[model samples]
Target: MTLDALRLEVPDILQEDAASLADLNEQLAEARLQPQEHALQQVLSLLFRLNRSAMTLLERQRALQSFSEEYRHYAAAYCAGVAPPILFVRFCAEIATGFKRLLLQILQGRQPSRPHLAWCLYMAQHFLAQSLLRHYQLYQEPPASLWRDSHLLYWLGEHQECLDEPVAAAFQPQPANTLRGLYQQMLLLALSNPFHLAEGESPLLFSALAPLASLARLLPWDVDDDAEGQTVDLTESQPCLAYDQAPEGDSHYLRRFELGALLVALHEPAPLQSALERQLLERVRHHWLGRQQRRHARSDHAGDCSLVVGLTAIHAQLLEHRPGHCAAQMLDTSPGGARLLCHADQGRLLPVGQLVLLLSSSATPTLALVRWRHLNVEGLHLGLRYLKGLPRPVWLRRAPSAQTHPGVLQSTPVQGGGWHHGLWLPNEQFVEEENLWLQLPNVHNQAALPLPAPNLATPLVARHPLKLA
Candidate 1:
C-alpha cells in the first residue's frame, strides 16, 4: 500500500533525493555508452519506495521475495553473457532494496524461516560480487588479469566462519581465479541454513559491514542470551518507567562482532598470503584499533530520573510511535547527548537519524537525533545527539522571586512517583528524589511552551499553560 493509505507522511528530503536521481537517470539515458552514474538512482529509488510504502508484514515479505526472484533472473542472464549492461544495474538495485527491506522487516517483527533467510544471504552475495565486478569493468581501468585474482572472493574467504558448511563448500568447486566459484559459494551460503550449527549463524552481518562499531553498533548478539522474539503490542501505550515495568541495563555493551570474526580469520590454518588481501586486512585492523580509542564517554548516574521525549513533526518513519509522546529512561549521559532505553514491546521505534524532542524541567526541550540503536532482550538502547545547545527554561533563565515560588504551589508536587526506575512527573516535589518534573519555567507566564510535561502527575492528560500557584 502507498504511504497515504497508512497515514504516513513522506519526508521532503526523500522526495528531493528521488527527484535528483531522476535527473541523473535522464542524463544517463541520453549517453547510453556512458557508465558515469550507473544504477545508483535506481538502487536508492527502490529503497525509498520500500521504506515509504506501508504494507502488512505478509505483503512486505512477498515484495522482498519478488525482488529476490528478479535478482536471480538477472544473475542467470549475466552468467550467460546475453544480459545487457543495464541488467547488472538492475541486479544491484534489487539487491540493495531487497536486503534493506529484509532488515527493516526484522525490526518490525517479521522473522524469516531458515530457508528464506538462506535465500536472502545467497542473493546478497551474488549481487554484491557482480556489482563490484561491473564497477571495476566500467568505472575503473583495471588490468585484464584482475579477474584471475578476484579480490571479492578473497574477501569472502576470510569470513567463512559466518557461512554454513554447505555454503563454504560451494566455493571449493570453483577453480582458483574464477568469479563463478565465489558467486556460487556465497549463493550456497545463502541457501544453507546453519542456524542449528554453532558456527553457521551470524545474523548480524550489517554490523560487520558498518564503518565503525564503537559509535554505531547496529546489532550485537549475546552468545548465551536467549534469542526468542519479543511480543509487541502496537496499540498499547507504554506507561512511564515510574509505573514499574522499565527495562534494566546500566551500560550498553560495545564489543566489535566483526573484530571477533576477523580474529577467527587470522587464526585460520591457511591464512591468506595474497598481497592485496594482506593489505586489506591490515587496513581494517588499523581502522578498528583507532575506533577503540575514540569511544564516547557515558555517565554512570541517570538514576531514578527519566527523560521525557516526544515525537516531533520533522521525523522519519523510523521512530514514529503511536499518535503522541513516548517516555524513555536515560541509561547514561555523554558530553553531546545521552543513551536511553524505551519499551520495545510497545512496538519498535527510533531508527537511526530520527529527530526527537527532549523535555527537561529546568531546561527547554532539547532536539536530539537518534545516532544508534541496539535492540536487546529488555528493549532498545538508543544513542541520541542533541541538535543544538541546551536551552534553559524561562523560569531558570530569570531570577527566582518569592512571588513565583509560592509556598502552597511549592508544597504540592503535582504528581507522586510511579514504579518507573526514572520517574519524571509534572511537579518539582519529586525533583529531589532524582526525579524530574516538567512545567512552564515561569509560573506567572501563560505562554505555551515547546515542552510537553507539566508539574502535574497526569502530564499526559494535562494541557498547555498549566496552572501553578
Candidate 2:
C-alpha cells in the first residue's frame, strides 16, 4: 500500500523548519511537567509530526533515534511500576503508527542508499519489537493490523537483501537485518513468558537474545515438519499458531520457526552476568522448544472469590483484618493454578507478576501470583498460580531503630513434602544472608537470616528463605 493510499492525516504542528532537534528538546521539556500518559502522547505526536515534515533522510534518522531514546526512558518508568491500561494500550498503538510511517517511507523509495535503508529497517523493527513486547507483557492479543504491517515489512526486507549480505544497525551490538533474523527476534519474544517477568526484565531478556536470534530458522509452515515447533500466521495477530491451530487453507502465509540452533547456543558456556539472567535464558529456550509440560490438568470451576493485590494491600487484609478490595468469579481450577474473571476496572489494578490473596467460601485463603491477564467487553480474565504455602502477615525490621516493613512468613513445601520457612518482603527490602528481626502477632521479635529463595513470579516482592539466627 502506498502512503497516499493509506491516507494518514498530517498533524497541524507541521511548519517551516519546525522539525529540528532544538524544537523537539523544548517540547520534551514541557512534556515532563504533564501527566505521564499525556506527556507520552504529546511527545509521540510531536515526533510523528517531525518525521513527516520536510527534512533530509539523515535528519529524519536522527529525529527517529532521539524519539526512541526518549521513549525508552518513559517505557522504563512504566515497567518499574503499575501503569494505566489506557496508557499501555496507547503506547503499543503509537509505536505501531510510528513504525508504519517509516515503512511507508522506505517502500516509496525515499531511502537514498542501501546502508541508509538498512538502518531505517532496523529502526522500524525496533519500533515493532517494542510494541510486541508491551502486548506480551500484559498477555493481550495483538490486533490484526499489527500482523498485516509486519507481513508487509518482512516482504520488503526479503526482496531487498542479497544472499548472505550483512545488515547492521547503528549502536546495535549484533547484526539482525535479515528477514529471518528480524522475524526470529519477534518469535523469541512471543515465546518468552513475559507475564512472569519482573519489572524491567523484558528489555534485559531481549538484549541477551539479540546475539542468538539469528540462529533460529524460519520456514514455510508445513504440518509434516515436526522440527518446526512454533507457528506464526502473518495474516493474524494472535499467539503462536501451534500445529493444532494451523488452518487447512492459507498455509503459504503461515511460518514456523525451529529453535535447534538457538538452543545449542544457549547451552554453550557464555559470560552470563547473573543467576537470574541464566534462569531467564533457560526459560526462553524451554518455551521456544515447546518443553513446558503442564504438571496439572485444569478442570472447569464455577464460584466467586474475593482478592487483595500487592504486598501492602495483602498484608493489610491478612494482618489488619480488612476486607478484600475486589471480587472475581472463578473460571477454572487446577492443582497448581486457577483462572478468574473480574471487572476490568479491578483487573487494571493487578499487574502481571503481582502477589494476590484469594479468599472463597469453599477454600481457605490462598496466596497466588497473577500469571496472566486479558481484558474484554465482559471483564478481565486472570490466570493465577498458587504459591507453595499459606502466609502469615508479619512486621520486619533490619535494626531496632529502623522503621518496620510489612512482610509475609510462610512454610513453603520443599522437596520430599518437607516444609521450609520463608519470608516475602517488598522488593529490594531484604538483603541476602542479612540478619533481620521478625515481629509476629502477640510474640516478641525473633532473629532470622534473610537468604535468597527461588525466584517466584512476584515482581513487587522478594522471596527469601528464613533461617533462625
Candidate 3:
C-alpha cells in the first residue's frame, strides 16, 4: 500500500507553498512562542506536512533536513538540562513517527533518485538510533512497532540495492553511508548498557559509534548457521531477541551480526581518543565479548530503606545528621549490589554514577553507586553496586591552610585482597595528582595523603584512592 493512501490530507497552510523555506521559518518562529512541548508537537506536524506536500524529491529532502536541524536543537537542550525529560521523550516519539511516514512515502512505486533515496534511508537509520537511545535513557523496552518498521525499511532497501548508498547530512560529524552500519551501531550501543552512562555521556558515545559501526557486520541467518550468539529476527515484532531462543520455526527473515571487527578496533590504542571514549569502548567489549562473569549471585529481597543522594547530601546525612533521606523499596540484593525502587521524584536526583547511602533497620548504612536506572509508570528502578567498607565522614583540603571540604573516607579491597583507603569528594574540590590533608573525627592531627589519579570520576564527585607505604 502507498503512503499517500494512508496519510491524512495536508493542512491548508502547507498545501500552497510547502516547498517555500520562508513560510517554514515563519511558522517555526511562531512555534517557538508556545510552550516547549506544545511547540515541538506543532513544529513536527508542520514539517511532516511540508514533506508530504512537496512535489519533487529535492523539496522533500529539504524539509527532512530542516526537520533534522530542529530535532538537534531540542536534543541539545534536553542534554544540557534546559528542557524537561517529558519533552525529550515526546520529541523522540514525534520524530520517529515523522521519519517513518516520510520513509514510506519515499519507498512507494516509482524509484527515487539515488541521492534522495540515500538521504531518506540515512535519516530513517538516524531516527532509529535516537529511538534506541530514548529507550536506553528511560530503561524501557523499544516498541515492537518500531522494530517492525525498521525491518520493513531494511528489507525494502535491500530489494532496491540501496542499503549501502552514501549520504551526508550537515548535522552528522561523518557521512552515514550504510543502513547496516547504523543498524549495527544501534545494536552495539544497546549491548553497551547505556543506562549505566553518566548524564551527557550517552550522546558522546552515540557519536563515537558512528565511525566504528562500519567495522561491524550483519548477515542473513540460517537454522544451520552455527554462530552461538545473538540473532536478529526481522519478522519478529520483538526487541533484541537471542539466537538460541529464536522461535522454533525457520524463516527467511532471520539474520545474524558479528562484532569481531568492532572488537578489534576497540582493542587498538589508536581509536581511543579520550579517556571517556576508552571507557565506553571497554564497556562494549566487556558486555559483548569479554568473559568476565558476575562476581556475586543475586537473590530476591524485599524491604524498605532510606536513601540519600549525591556526595554533599551523603556527607550531610552522615556527619551532620541531616534529614535528606528518601524512602525506597529493595527489589533484589546480593553482597556486591542491590536493585531498588523509589519514587520518580527522588530518582531524578540520582543519576548514574551518583553516590548514595542506603540505610535499613537490619543493617548499618551502606555506600553504593547508582550503576543503572529506569523510569516507568510504576516508579524509578535503580541498580546499585555497593562500595566496599564502611564510610566515615572526613574533612579534606589541599593543605592545613586551605579551606576544608566535606568528604568520605572509605576502604576498598585491592586486587591481591588487601584494603586500600580512598576519599570521595565533590568534583569541584578534587585535584589531580595533588596531596590532600584529611582531618579525622575526634583527632587533633591531620594526615597528609597523596591524591593518586582517580579511577572513578563522575560529574558530581571523584574518588581518589591513596597508596600507603
TM-score for each of the candidates: 0.28, 0.76, 0.84
* Residue 463 lDDT (model 1): 16
Tell me the lDDT of candidate 2: 0.67
Query: What overall lDDT goes with each candidate model?
Result: 0.36, 0.67, 0.70
lDDT of 2 by residue, 30-78 (tens): 8878987788788867765665566654565566666666666676565
lDDT of 1 by residue, 134-249 (tens): 43222222222222222222223223222332232121112112222333322222212211111101112111222121121113334354332111111112101111232342
Highest TM-score, which number?
3
Estimate the lDDT of model 3: 0.70
Cα shift from native, residue 387, model 3 (Å)? 1.3
**After best superposition, candidate 1 residue 383: deviation in angstroms?**
0.2
Q: Which of the two, 2 or 3, has more TM-score?
A: 3
lDDT of 3 by residue, 1-469 (tens): 2212133222233455445666876777788788777888788667556544644545655666666777766665556322245555545555655555566667674867776766676676677667767666656666766666666666666766767776665443232457767766776776676667777666667667777787876677776876644676666665447523745435566667677777778767664367777776776667653233778999999999978888778887877678578889999999999999999887668888889999999888899888888777778889999987869888887889789888888876678777788788878666676777888788888888777787777777788877644
lDDT of 1: 0.36
